[model samples]
Every structure is written in structure tokens, then in C-alpha cells.
Target: MGSFEFLLDGIVRAFELIVTLNPYILSITGVSIKVSGTATLLAAMTAIPLAFALSFVQFRGRHAVITLVNTGMGLPPVFVGLFVFVMLVPAGPLGFLNRIFTPEAMIIAQYILITPIITGITLSAIKAVPEPIIETVYTLGGREKDVVLTTLLEARFGVITAVLAGLGRALAEVGAILIVGGNIAYTGSVGGIGEGLSYTRTLTTAITSETSKGDISTSIALGIILIAIYLFVNVAAGFFRRQD
Candidate 1:
């Protein structure tokens, strides 16, 4: 009975915190969205062309490249973080960029983590496109670009699912972003209002912090929001699936 009452109290407090727009929670949520969205967009931009090339072009080492991409799908995030940190270190060749421990660094890490996923899934989608569709477009005297575009369009549903899968991976990730971004929250002025921002303190990070500190109410609230976001993504994916 005591445990049940405690759980009920925590739930009520969590809802209160969410409804009241707690700054720490809101800030973490904002950072998560920004980092995840930017990573997804950048990954898509790069992956789409790579997917097309892999699907339609024949060249030396093509099989090797595909194999590498497939392997990247299961990459360990902590290892990626360690590798990137080495390259971005002060003495490293490209260290002039000074991208470490910033939102930009977090985005970069996420891009690397998610790009392989995007590429692998996109390759699957493109390959799933009917061969007759490709040949039909080609036989109609369509340009190579036109045929590729048509193939992509025909596989649009699968492509969108691939993107969602990449996003799901990105949003749920922790290790890479935590390592590169340092999980430090920043405080400063935002449009004349005091605001806190963190390059790495995503919803997951916030939940971790809250749980460690025994802030069950806030942790529960953040968990709810995280679940809501995942549900929304799944719902959106379902809509696109139906469209395809």
C-alpha cells in the first residue's frame, strides 16, 4: 500500500512538472529535438545519393563499400564517440574546427551514428523497387536521372520507413552524444530571457540525471515525454506506410 501511494504521488507530481513547463526539462527536450532533427536531415541528404549510386551504378570496390555500410548499421555508439573524439582532438589534423563539446559536435556525432543506418535501409528500399519499373522507365527513353527518380518515388514508402528508423535510432542514442557533447548544460540569454541549454543533455540524459538524484517525479515526466515522441514517430510512419 505504501509503495502504491508513493507511485501515485510521483505520477501526480510528474504531471504537474510537465504542465508547469519546468525549465530544465524543457531545455533538455529542445536540445534533443534540435540535435536529432539536424542529424536526420543531414544523414538523409548524404544517404539518398549514396543509396542511388549503390543501387544503380557499377564500379570497382562497390561490394566492399556495401559491406562496410551494412556493418555500420550495428556500430557501437561508444566506439564511434571515442574515434570521433580522437580525430577532433586539439592536435588532430582537423582540430581547427574546435567542434567538440558543442551542439554542432553532437550533431556531427549523431550524423555519423545514423548515416550508416540511413544508407543501409535506403539501399534495401531502393533494391526492393521492382526491376520492371526500372526497365520500363528506361525503355521509355527516360534519362538515367529520370529513371533513378522514378525508382526512388516507387520506393518512397520504404525510404520514408528507413528514415524513421534512422530517426528512432538517433533519438534513442546516448553514448556518442554524451561523450562528444559532455552533457553539460549551458546558461545564457535567449531573446532577453534567461535560458539553459545543453549540447548533450537530451531527454535521456535528463532522465539519467533525475533518476540519479532521486527526482522521481521529474524523471517520470521526462519518460512520458520520451514515450510520446516515440509514439508520434511510429504513428507518422504508419501514415506513410499506408500512403505507400
Candidate 2:
């Protein structure tokens, strides 16, 4: 086939897989959403609270804490993967949990990678709150708890944006999860295809694996799904920013 026709044929077959909801495709998509979604949720929960503390509480070494957050925000994904892998591998510390090459391990790696991102963004959002509003709360005899709550409400939109950013990062991530998760799929065949249902496989990791193996059709199918996810998240982020 000519190059144009070859590319067109691959795309056609890709859409076919998507339209049919091929079991393997569906499985990896589901796993991607599950792992990224869970990690984003957990990171938000942890980061938001910590961000509030950093914003409101007066404590020593606060600068050091902020420095750490900034540092972590730029941490390399592969490095994070290596760190987690070391701790989880047999004979390594914390290896007794035996979480290597599991979804849980992927979650843990993503959590570490994105926690600082969420925290840094949340801290900035909380800091952006107008000083007068906080003063008004205090003037009205509002306690520290009330002040914190009011600030959180004022920055709610930014927090939402932060969470969405973390989700996007988690979804697009491949390096860390590839290492910690092992990009594992079932060993057996499905529909006579060599690939099986997802075990720890995810869309991003699967795309890399498929493309590297020269399975252009499967890679295109997965790429379509991944782009759809990214579009959805970006749309949501845009909506929330407009609300802000």
C-alpha cells in the first residue's frame, strides 16, 4: 500500500476497535482512569489540607517546606519511578508489602509525583486570597477555623483547577507507571489477538508498548482514546477557570 493509504487503513481499523469497544482497549482505558483518578483524588485530599496549613499557620522552617514543594513540583518522573521501585523490590525496605508491578505501586508513584504539584498550586491559590477578606473575618470575631474555611471558599475555583492539573499529569504520565506498574497485561490472547485483558496496563503505557512493537493500528486506537481523555479534562479545566 502507498504511505497515505497505509496510514488511512490504520486509522480506519483504529476507529473500528474503538467503535466495537474491543475488550483489550476497554480494559486498559478503564485501568488508566482508575489509577489516575485514584491518585489525583488522594493527592488533592492530602495536598489541599497541607496547603491550607502552609497558608494559614505560622510556623518555623516554613520556607524550607515551601522550597521542598517547589523542588518536588519539578521532580523527574523516571526518578520517582526508580525511587518507588527500589523501595518495593524484594530485599528493599518496605518490600514486605510486595506491591511491585501492581496498580497500587503505580498509584503510590503517581501520588508522590503529583502531591507537590497540587500542593504548590493550592498554596498559590490560597495565598491569592485578598487580605481584606481575611481581616474582615477576623474583625467579625471569626475564629481561626472560620478564617481558614472562608479562605478555602474564596479559592475553591483555583483548587479545582489544581486538582484538574494533577489529573492531567497523572493521565499523561508513562515513565513512572511503566516502571512501577510494569505495564502488565494478561498473557493470553483475546479475539485471536496476542494481547489480553489489562492487568496493570494503562492507555499511556500501552501506547508506548504498542508503538514500540510496530502495532500501528493498536497504537492509533489507544491514541484516540487518550486524546479524548485529554480533551475532556481540558474542557473541564476551561469551564472552571471561566467560573473563577
Candidate 3:
């Protein structure tokens, strides 16, 4: 087939898989959402509070903590994967949890990877809150707690963008989850598509595996889904920013 024809065929096949709910494709998409979604939530919880604390509190080593968070924002995903793999290995320090090669391991790795990104962005957002706005809260009989709350409300949109950014990073990530999650699937059949329910086979890893096995149609389907999700997240973030 000609290149255009081949590309057309792939797009048609991808849409078919999606509309038909191809078992393998659905399973991979599910894993991607569950793992990345959970990690993003966990990261947001931790990062938001830390960001707030860093913004409001004057304490020793504050600069050090900010520096560390900044550094962590750029951590290499593959190196994080290796570190988590080691920590979860049979003889490793946390091996007793026996979470290696599991969805939980993937969550942990992704959480570590995205936490700093969220925290750093959130911190910046909080810092950007106008000093006059904070002072206005205080001028209106607001206490320290009120000031913090008011600042947080003002920065809410930016913080939401930070969380979305982390979610996007988590969803697109493959290296860390691949090492820790193992991308395994159980033997099974679904909708007569001869697909197995995935344990750790997220969309990104599934695309890699499917393409390597010459399942170009499946790969294309997954790639389309992944891009669609990333786009949605970014668009949502932009909307919230505009509202802010």
C-alpha cells in the first residue's frame, strides 16, 4: 500500500478498535488511567501541602528544601525506575512489601516522579499570589490562617494546572512504570479479540510491545488514545487558567 493508504488504514483500524472496545486496547487504557490517576492524586495531596507550607512558613533550611524540590522536578524517569526496582527487589530494603512488578510499584514510582513537578509548580503559583491581595486579607481582620487560605484560593487555578501537568507527565511516562510494573497480562479472552486483561500493561508500554510484535494496528490505536488523553488534560488546564 502507498504511505497515505497505509496511514489511512491505520487510522481506520484505530477508530474501529476504540469504538468496538477491543479487549486489549481497553485493558491497556484502563491500566494507564488507574495507575496514573492514582499517582497524580497522591502527588497532589503531598505536593500541595508542601507547597503551601513552603510558601507561608519561615523556617531553617527552607531554601534547601526549595532547591531539592527544584532538582527533583528534572529527575530522570529511567533512573527513578531503577531506584524503585532496587528498593522493591527481593533483597532490597523494602522488599518485604513484595510489591515489585505490580501496579502498586508503578504507582509508587510515578508518585515519586511527579511529586516534585507538582510541588515546584504549586510553590511557584503560591509565590505568585500578589502581596497586596494577601495584605488585603489581613487588612480585613483576617488572621494568619485566613491569609493562607485566601492566598490558596487565589492560586487555586495555577495549582490545578500543576496537578494537571503532573497527570500529563504520569500518563505519558513509560520508563519508570515499565521497570516497576513489568507490563504483564493474564491469559484470557475478551470480546473475541484474543486479548488478555492487563496487570501492568499501560497504553505506552502496550504500544511498544504491540509494535515490536508487528501489531501495527494495535499500536496505532494506543498511540491515538494516549495523545487524546494528554490533549484533554492540557486543554482542561488551559480552561481553568483562563477562568482564573
Q: How accurate locally, in lDDT, is each candidate?
A: 0.83, 0.93, 0.91
**Model 2 per-residue lDDT at 77:** 99
Clashing residue pairs in candidate 1 (N, C-alpha, C atoms within 3 angstroms): none
Q: How do the residues 109-185 of candidate 3 rate in per-residue lDDT, one tens digit apiece?
A: 99999999999999989989989999899889999999888888999888888998899899989999999999898
* lDDT-based ranking: 2, 3, 1
Candidate 2 lDDT, 1-244, residue by residue in tens = 8989878988998999999889999999999999999999999999999999888888999989999999999989999999999999987897999999999999999999999999999999999999999999999999999999999999988898888889989999999999999999998889555989998999999999998998888998998898899898879778867876
Candidate 2 pairs with clashing backbones: none
Go through the candidates in order and give the clash count of each.
0, 0, 0
**Model 1 TM-score relative to the real fold:** 0.90
lDDT of 2: 0.93
Where is the poorest 10-residue window by lDDT in model 1?
190-199
lDDT of 1 by residue, 122-201 (tens): 99989888789888998999989998889888888778877888888988888988887888877786423244655568
Candidate 1 regions with alpha-carbon error over 4 angstroms: 187-199, 240-244
**What is residue 163's positional error in candidate 3, in angstroms?**
0.4
The TM-score between candidate 3 and the true structure equals 0.94
- Candidate with top lDDT is 2
Candidate 3 displacement at residue 211 in angstroms: 1.4
